[model samples]
Target: MTHTSTAQTTTDEFIRLGLDVLDTELTAIDGLRRYIDADFAHACELLLACTGRVIVIGMGKSGHIGGKIAATLASTGTPAFFVHPGEASHGDLGMITAADVVIAISNSGETNEVLSIAPLIKRRGVRLIGMTGNPQSTLADLADVHVCIAVEKEACPLGLAPTSSTTATLVMGDALAVALLHARGFTADDFALSHPGGSLGRRLLLHIHDVMHKGERIPLVDESATISQALLEMSRKGLGMTGITDAGGKLLGVFTDGDLRRILDQRLDVHQTPIAQVMTRQPITISADVLAAQGLKLMEDRKINGLFAVDADGYPQGALNMHDLLKAGVL
Candidate 1:
């Protein structure tokens, strides 16, 4: 065979192998739907009732999945953390308390490291939820509740490495976390509290008022002010827009760089014309109580770069630009 033909054959085999792995794993995950039964409910109940935390324990690949499960639980309103079974046997067992619930993951349900620490966990009277592919395994029989992550077969061609089994276990972990999340009436705001350091947290929890320029930083021009004065206010504030307010400080209109362009096109005298005549009446605005993400959406959808945070009475309380959202991690 030519070199090009050999290379084509190799690439085709790789694609075939990858698709086979995915198809096998997809079948395994789909089979998990039936396992969300009473036993799963019991596990979720045990986790929800615990006042302390969910202690996830496993060995090897199971340990990696357990860590992710613990993180998902914690971020979704269930206080949980991972404890390596080997470490637990040595000293980390102290972290598990009677108020805490244990989630033990083992493909065979006979992992030595996990089984070694099982007795100590049992002695503490902590609730144990076993996640294993083997329902008949020792870990399953010993637990207060068992969640079967049993898969028909491993996606690994040799059946020696974990592939389908681990995916099923991870999906089972997600099911447990989501069940508890809904049971506890968890909201996006609640999820945001645990994830305050990330983009998701900023989108859900950061409010417009948190990032808006308030007080003197808000570019304001009197309705009677000349267009020249409005330009000076917009430039001084560097927000690309200025709010035109009445004598009582209630917002009347908005003059923006775009509005200035229109006036320039009309050959209107900036020095002779009043800002209100050139301003956009009933301009789009947002409330301070809304999230900064919503503010970003409003600016994007309206095809504008600047916005005013207004009160219910149409008074401009603050001003913000796209730069503010970017600076506050809300973009």
Candidate 2:
């Protein structure tokens, strides 16, 4: 009983500590609003007008944060990359060109590695934007534009770990990247171009034509075909559905496995009944140019599992189903 009571007390203390850390970090982030002033705008303008890439540099925990910031910027339509301050001093400094803009990050604003390369970076006639906690420190003074990310206190109990300050820096980086993205009128299509391997890219870039069955693969039957013939076509094509078309090759209707089940009790003569008599007329059809994602939504909205891609004149061009979308990674 005593051990259980002690364990409960320890758990409660841990929860309290976790909550306190969250509150501290929240307060630190909230305090950053005042710092997003004209200086911040100026830094963004400089970056926006830059003809070359944006170079991000930092030390220690700030380096990790800087790397993420650079990635976010690059992915969000801004061309940016991270270079370690220590590496910049050795040889990576060659990566920065005169037309490029440099963003230097340091919590103390006095990191020796970062400060060591500041003069050399300036000598290249490159614009320098500094992000630091100390607005009055040497890095801030040396920078052409200084964005202060001062936090009231660290979330760490000992006040030594970089907790609130790093969070503020990351948020600031996002703000810059998003602001630039909006200013440049970056579209989802543009984002997909950079992230073609991601799911969003597949949804945006893959079209019905890209994933649909074409040529002889499309499950199709003449309107005059009997229900049994339509079933044969559906089976041969393996799409669980068949497009019923007229003699002129214009799509008239569609017959699916669901239709087969529904008419099972009707006792209709499969060999004698025409497919057009039992098929779904004016069924939901997608254009060959439509996005695969849009096709997925149409199927979901109409409670369907398959679709036929039709041309402008209602000619069946191709066919696809949920499984095709899954195979294409669009699902």
Candidate 3:
């Protein structure tokens, strides 16, 4: 009993510590609101007006956060990259040009590696923006614009680990990236261009024409085709559905496996019953130019498993099913 109680107490203590850390980090982030003044705006303006890339440099934990910040900025329409402070001193400093803007990150504002290269960076006539905990430190003084990320205390119990400060820095980076993203009128289409291999890219860049069955692959039958003939087309095309069209190739209605199941109990004569008699009238159709992702949403909203891509004149142009969307990675 005593051992069990001890285990329970330890679990409770761990939960409390985790909550305390979250609270501390949240407080630290809230404290940054006061520091988002004119200096932050100037930094954004400088970055926006730059003709060259944005260079991010830092040391230790700040380096990891700086790398993420740089990636966020680059992916959100701003051209940016990360350069280690230690590497900048050796040879990577050549990557920076006079047309570029450099963002230097250091919690103490006195990191030797970062401070060592500050003067050289300034000599290139490049604009320098410093992010540090100290507003009056040497790095802040050397910087043309200083953004203070001071926190009341570290979330680490020992007060040594970079916990709250790093979180604040990352949040500040996101704020800058998002502000620039909106200012430049960056659209989802632009974001998809950079993330073509991702799920968002598939959803935004892929259209119905890219994944739908076309020409001979479309499961379709004449409006006068018997229900048995429509079923044969459905089976042959393997899309679990068939569209009923008129002699002029205009879509009239649709019949699916679900409809087949429903009519089975009604004892409908498959050999003589006209497809248009049992087919769903004016079925939901999508345009070939519509995004495949929107097609998926339409199917889900209407609780369907298949759809036909039709022309503006209501002629069947292509067909697709949920499986096609899954294969296209839009699912």
Q: Give the better candidate number (1 or 3) by TM-score.
A: 3
- Over 1-331, each residue of candidate 2 has an lDDT whose tens digit, in order, gives 4544434457788899999999999998999999889999999899999999999999999999999999999988889999998988889999999999999999899999999999999999999999999999999999999999999999998999999999999999988899899988999889888889978899989999999999999999999999999999999999999999999999999999999999999999999999999999999999999889999999999999999999889998999999999999999
Best by TM-score: 3
lDDT string for model 3 (1-331, tens) is 4544434457788899999999999999999999899999999999999899999999999999999999999999999999998998889999999999999999999999999999999999999999999999999999999999999999999999999999999999999999999999999889989899968899989999999999999999999999999999999999999999999999989999999999999998899999899999999999999899999999999999999999899998899999999999999
Report lDDT (CA) for all predictions: 0.92, 0.94, 0.96
Q: Please, what's the RMSD in Å of model 1? A: 3.0
Top candidate when judged by lDDT against the true structure: 3
Instruction: Give lDDT: candidate 2, residue 24.
Output: 95
Worst 10 residues of 1 by lDDT: 1-10
Candidate 3 regions with alpha-carbon error over 4 angstroms: 1-9
Candidate 3 overall lDDT versus native = 0.96
Minimum summed lDDT over a 10-residue window in model 3 is located at 1-10
RMSD of 3: 3.2
Candidate 2 deviant stretches above 4 angstroms:
1-9
Alpha-carbon RMSD of each model:
3.0, 3.2, 3.2
Worst 10 residues of 2 by lDDT: 1-10
